[model samples]
Target chain A: SQTIHQWPATLVQPVGSPLSLECTVEGTSNPNLYWYRQAAGRGLQLLFYSVGIGQISSEVPQNLSASRPQDRQFILSSKKLLLSDSGFYLCAWDIGTGGTETQYFGPGTRLLVL
Target chain B: GQQVMQIPQYQHVQEGEDFTTYCNSSTTLSNIQWYKQRPGGHPVFLIQLVKSGEVKKQKRLTFQFGEAKKNSSLHITATQTTDVGTYFCAAPYGNNRLAFGKGNQVVVIP
Candidate 1:
């Protein structure tokens, strides 16, 4: 069974602070990883995705960036956070091959910027 | 960029009633996938449709992909209180990226 993990489960930060959210997957290797954000009562927005280590694609470029340091470890970071940057952050992984495209999501990290 | 539009932004129904959410795409899709997100939780993969006009069912849930391969729908029969959540239709945008719709938030009153 494959599982995704993300942390810290919740965070409160002042404006203009740095941000670091981590995601790691187990039971899979070379899977496609993605980062998504959802605002309260709003839909999801694709932030970044990586097919492999050191490869990241930005969907809606803004104040955030993502990195794949290892085969199953992905990190979302920001040098400075904006008020609008606060949201429910999720990490997902998919087979990306073998004719399957279903994505598995993590527990998610909720960030509140004040 | 591929755009996915889902309708019935929100819905409230009796626990035994039926509900459906539709999704349309600006461009043709190789495949479409459905996801459900419980309130305050992350999105979970529900199902996927590929072949044109394909239909699949899971228990009381039915999923359909349009003949044009540009639209899809998810229908729930005799909805349960546990069905309360936001349903989203997503399509592959590019290489390995997925574009998700705004989602249809369903509320079931018991």
Candidate 2:
């Protein structure tokens, strides 16, 4: 079966510090990858999605950016973190297209910016 | 941008009582997907609904896609404490990205 992995599990950072969160998927190739953030007790906000290697689509223009270096490796990064950037970050992958498609998610990483 | 809206930001119910959450979309969706997120966990895909007036059930949970294909609902019979979590309905925005609602947080008091 396919599985997704995300790291640092939890992170604490100071303001203006750089941020890097990694996500990797096994058992799938050319899968659609997405980056999402959820504030405390709030809905998820889509930050970025990549269709293929080196192709990313930004949903919300913010301090954060996303890149798919390899087919199954996606990275979410920020040059400088803001207090508002603190949240539960998630990485998801979908097998194919359309609104009806199902998405599998990773365990997620909780980041707190001080 | 397509907008997805869910009703009752929060629902509190006693265990064994029924629970339901509704999702509406600004535009006609080709399909809708449901996800459940535990208190401290990531969102997990529950089910997907396609076709107008489609009805699907998984054990005690019943999912319905509106005849107009613009809304959906998730109904759980005999709610359990394990059902406590945020239920989000997501739909594709264009071709790839999905737009999620604020989600309805279900709290089951056992």
Candidate 3:
């Protein structure tokens, strides 16, 4: 079975501080990884996605960036956090070659930028 | 640009009642997938439909893909309190990337 793990389940940071969130998947290799954010009572917003190592695609321009350092390790980072950056961040993985592939999500990390 | 839209942003239903949510896309899709997210939890893959006019079922849940491949729907029979959550419809366009609908928040009242 495939599973995704995200760190810092919850975080509180002051404005203008640096932020880093990590996501790692087990039981799969060369899977597609994605980062999504959701504000309170709002819908999920795609932030970034990576098909392979060192390859990242930005879906929405914002204060965040994503990186794939290893086949199953993805990281979302921000040099400086903004008040609007407060939201729940999620990591997902999908089988790259399968038809009608479904994304599996991690527990998610909630950040509160004050 | 491709866009997917879901109707009834929020729905309240009595336990054991039937419920359905519709998803529409501006452009044709190769396939459509459904996901469910419990309150305060991450989204979970529910099902996927590919062929035009295809229909698949899982227990009390039924999924449909439109003949035009521009729409889809998820129907649940005899909803339960455990079904309270937000349902999202995702469609993959030309790229492997998926675009998700705004989602329909379902609240089952017991």
Tens digit per residue, CA lDDT, model 3, A5-112: 999999999999999999999998899898999998778888888889999989888999999989999999999999999999999888865324988999999999
Specify the highest-DockQ model's number: 2
**DockQ each:** 0.59, 0.81, 0.57
User: Over the true interface residues, superposed, what is the Cα RMSD of model 3?
Assistant: 2.1
Sorted by DockQ (best first), the order is 2, 1, 3
In terms of docking quality, how is candidate 2 classified? high
TM for every model, in the order presented, reads: 0.96, 0.98, 0.96
What lDDT is reached at residue A54 by model 3?
Answer: 99
User: Best candidate per lDDT, number?
Assistant: 2
Instruction: Report the lDDT tens digits of candidate 3 across residue range B1-110.
Output: 56799998999999999999999987888889999999999999998888999999999999999999999999999999999999999887545577888899999999
Candidate 1 chain B: minimum summed lDDT over ten consecutive residues — where? B91-100
Stretches of candidate 2 off by over 4 Å are: none
Each candidate's lDDT (Cα)? 0.91, 0.93, 0.91
Off by over 4 Å in 3: A97-99
**Per-candidate TM-score, chain A:** 0.95, 0.97, 0.96
Residue range B78-99, candidate 2, lDDT tens digits: 9989999999999988768889
